[model samples]
Target: MNRLRAVVTEIEGEQNLHIITFDCAGSSLKMMGLDLPKGLHLNSHVILGIKPSHVAIAKHLSGELSYSNQLQATIASIENGKLLSNILLHVKESDVQSFITLSSSKRMNLQVGEQVTLLIKASELFVLEVLDA
Candidate 1:
């Protein structure tokens, strides 16, 4: 799992379900679920969690996307395996890791220091741990 420290910006909804928005690496991100931990409030610091497989990569991307979280990142390192490739990206203040297919890696021609976009759906992201202000 990949973890990022984020600060809660807004929270809305009922007791059972809530739509929570947060700031992660200067980008707005949201999470919607009933299983969110307790004691979260505005400006609360939280750890955002997502799996590497859930992350998608785009090269030279343009136009709007359905994904709620889109972050601009630079390739830091890449390890191509037999069937999969592990990609390390440097975001504003965090290192985001992604697991993609080797074929896709080759097709995109991703290299170290290359600029790429990281796309992640809101539903795929969750709050791992909540901290006090």
Candidate 2:
């Protein structure tokens, strides 16, 4: 699991389902969820969590994409396995990791220091923990 410390910036939508936005590493992150935990309000500090497998990489991405979170980052390092590839990315002051297939990594020709876009869906995000402001 990937974890990020963030603060809730905004919240929208009806009961049971909401579009929650957060300020993380100077970037705005959005998450779609069925329910907001009790006492979770705007400005509340929380821990954002996502699975490495859920992260998608895009090269020279253009136009509109359905994914709510698109982070601009650079490949920091890569650990290629027999079937899976572990990618480390540097985004602002944070390091994000992604697990992708070796074939996809080769198809993209990803290299260290190469610019790439990280795509993450709102639904893939989860509130790992809420911290005191």
Candidate 3:
């Protein structure tokens, strides 16, 4: 399957990295990276300009991530609205999914336009959230 590449367009800071917006060839998704240390402002950082990074792939997206450890994505597509579509995910070939588990229905409910996190080792990405919107 062909892959999508997006540029980091915006970043917001809170106690942790609040949100990241990307220009996915005009298609975009918001990704949550890390938690704020102790006393960090949400606007302390600015969206940075850098070459596109494989930051995330949308799979089982719900709404905005709520759990400090969980994220959600909204399902939207070019042709039709994918309501409760089973989320499909793609990642670096070397990344492992053994540790990630989902219920049978969850695995089945995932559909096109759904969202799933890029879940990876922090070392894999040179993260930045400053400048650019």
Candidate 4:
């Protein structure tokens, strides 16, 4: 099962970019102005609990093939050149009918309401900083 989890409470956003606020229920992730990836609709995402082993992959968006743990979350929002995603998210407070984005590809093996467990690492979670090119 996957480990990333999120519930969107308010998707104050538009196509390709938006502010997605969620609750992890495991920790306090209150870092403001998070940088998410692009191509994210409003509801297309997977909250992930990154493990220490996957920390490098999560931060770099690259994973090893042996683990077969290819988790890629939709860009909740982007700043500078970095991408961001919310885990254990909340998106119920605001009434919306946004289209959900399936996984990055057809082979993601994910379904709506499907339970997943993320291999979380303490180092994976951190405050984002925009890198100027």
Candidate 5:
């Protein structure tokens, strides 16, 4: 899992559903969920988690997208296997890992130091832990 330290900036929802926003190294990220743990409130410090396989990479992306989290990052390193590829990305001050198919990696022609956009769905992000206030 890729973990990022963030602070809760906003929370909006009704009933059990919620849309939580966070400030991660100056980048805004969002998480959607139905259940929130105790102590998760505005200005709360948190550690966000997401699986590497869930991260999507976009190169020269244009037009609009529905994904709530789109982080601009630079490719730090890439390790390709026969079937899968592990890509390390530098986003702001954080480093995020992305797992994609070898075919996709080649098709995108991703290289070290290249610029790419990381796409993450809101529902895929979760509060891995709530930091002490």
Candidate 6:
């Protein structure tokens, strides 16, 4: 899992469903979930987690997307295997890894230091740990 340190900025929704927004090094990220952790509230410091395979990469992307979290990143390194490719990205100060098919990696021609956008669904992100009350 890729973990990022963030602070809760806002929260919306009713009852069991909620859409929580966070700020990670000035980047806005959102996560949707059915349950909220105890003592979680505005300004809470948290560690967010997501799986590598859940991260999507886009080069020269345009227009809007349905994904709730979109982060600007640069390719740090890539390891291509026969069936899958692992891409390491530098997002601000954090290093996030993404796993994509080897074919997709070649099709995008992703290289080290290339600029790309990382897309992640809100439902895929979760609060891995709460650092503060």
Tell me the alpha-carbon RMSD of every candidate: 1.5, 1.1, 11.3, 16.2, 0.8, 0.7
24: Cα error in model 1, Å: 1.6
Could you give candidate 3's per-residue lDDT for residues 1-133 as a string of tens digits? Answer: 1233446556676884556555543434455657532322433333322222323333545676432322233333222123322223333222212122235325445454544554322223333443323
Residue lDDT tens for model 1, 3-45: 9999999888897888889998778988888855777888999
Residue 132 of model 2, lDDT score:
73
Quote each prediction's TM-score.
Answer: 0.93, 0.95, 0.29, 0.23, 0.98, 0.98
lDDT tens per residue, model 5, 4-119: 99999999999999999999999999999998867898999999999999999999999999999999999999999999999999999899999999999999999999999999
- At residue 47, candidate 4 shows an lDDT of 48
Tens digits of per-residue lDDT, candidate 6, 59-87, equal 99999889989999999999999999999
Score residue 124 of candidate 1 by CA lDDT: 88
Task: List lDDT for all candidates, in order.
Answer: 0.91, 0.93, 0.37, 0.31, 0.96, 0.96
**Candidate 2 lDDT tens digits, 47-83:** 8998999999999899999898999999999999999
| Per-residue lDDT of 24 in model 3 | 43
C-alpha positional error of residue 111 in candidate 2 after TM-score superposition, expressed in Å = 0.1
Q: What is the lDDT, from 0 to 100, of the residue 123 in candidate 4?
A: 29
Models sorted by lDDT, best on top: 6, 5, 2, 1, 3, 4
Model 4, runs deviating above 4 Å? 26-46, 49-133
Cα misplacement distance, residue 30 of candidate 6 (Å): 0.3
Off by over 4 Å in 6: none
